[model samples]
Target: MFYGKYYLLFFISCSPFCLLGQKAVGIGTSNPRVTLEVAGDAITRDGIEIGVIDDMVDADTSTFLVQEDASNKLKTLDVSNPTGTALGYIQEYIIENPNEDWVLNLDTNISATEFVVNTISAYYNRELDIDGYATVPNFSAYIQDGTWRLTADFPSANNLYDNEIGTWTITTLIYSRDLSKQLGTITIPMNNGSEGSHANPIID
Candidate 1:
């Protein structure tokens, strides 16, 4: 009775997804639990693979590049890292620094913008605060084909003082198409001029 039951148990174990008692195909592994058990270093010529493989590190251009360093250390340049794709960078900014100011780099190859993001056909420039209000310096820039410009309206309504000779430490954050970086602070000396408008951003 014990021998009979042992054979029955073996038959039942291979009942589902097993083929005619054939040997299973194990990819990158010696012991395969399933019909196609791939333990490591798996690759599909056409299907979508998430990560890169070291086996093809020398000649694989279809996936993220993997190469050896000067110290003979292998390095993998993660494709997921910022290659400066418009939507990729935009999404990263939204996730990492949601409240941070977003700027565009107008000096880069605008062709990418024209191809992916919305087109800036004409001379275009904009500046706004998180509250949707113009900043104290009214931070702004303009870049068209053959021109580059930046302007700010210092001593804005949000920043008005009563001193005859005052200073404004403007913290300027930049987020542009080709660049997203902190440009540090700018010291703008101000003076409530002897007349009307304040000499806020003294361009001298």
Candidate 2:
């Protein structure tokens, strides 16, 4: 039995589905059980032929979303690990780093506040949090029309304090070459008044 459902044993021809059998094969899961039988040139309603089924699979899995890395490369995520799904992948990046901040190097020039990260897909019940001193902030970035752009800064309210923690996904990582290599480095405009020497990220 597959998922506690019983099927009849027979090879039948149907379109869009390929299962035609009433035999109970042991597949112990709560998920619905289905039986598929294919004879050359015959298909069924529950399952299609191997080649047709393969084509129906989506390239992106439901477990994770895709985001562009700092280098503009795509990365897969495991969204199941987080509490929210509607929140973007950029939110996931920030949640991974609570005590420290992050930065990225986009190959173009841009200001911080003007940056925005676009989601290729929409999720449900997502949220974001960011916490740090005002000097340098953690954020995301993206490339547009061959030029670099600064995305939005993370939301400070949801931040993880000494004992409290929050989460977010990062669609992009915009950092300077120097900060990219350092764990806790954050970027501040030359005129901003905050001052602090760089420190390695604290991992506990």
User: Tens digit of lDDT per residue, candidate 2, span 53-118?
Assistant: 443365644554344567544344454456643323342233333332222343335333344343
**lDDT over C-alpha atoms for residue 9 of model 1:** 93
Looking at model 1, residue 6 earns an lDDT score of 93
lDDT of residue 120 for candidate 1: 21
TM-scores vs. true structure, each candidate: 0.23, 0.18
Q: Which one is best on TM-score? A: 1
List where candidate 2 sits over 4 angstroms from the true fold: 1-95, 99-117, 120-140, 143-160, 171-204
Estimate the Cα RMSD of every predicted model relative to the unseen true structure. 19.2, 19.9
Residue range 1-204, candidate 1, lDDT tens digits: 999999999879977646636677676788888656777554356866456546656455433333344554434545344562222222111111111222233333334333223222121122323344454433443565644433333322322222222222222223344332334456544455554443454343
Off by over 4 Å in 1: 1-26, 29-135, 141-143, 146-150, 153-204
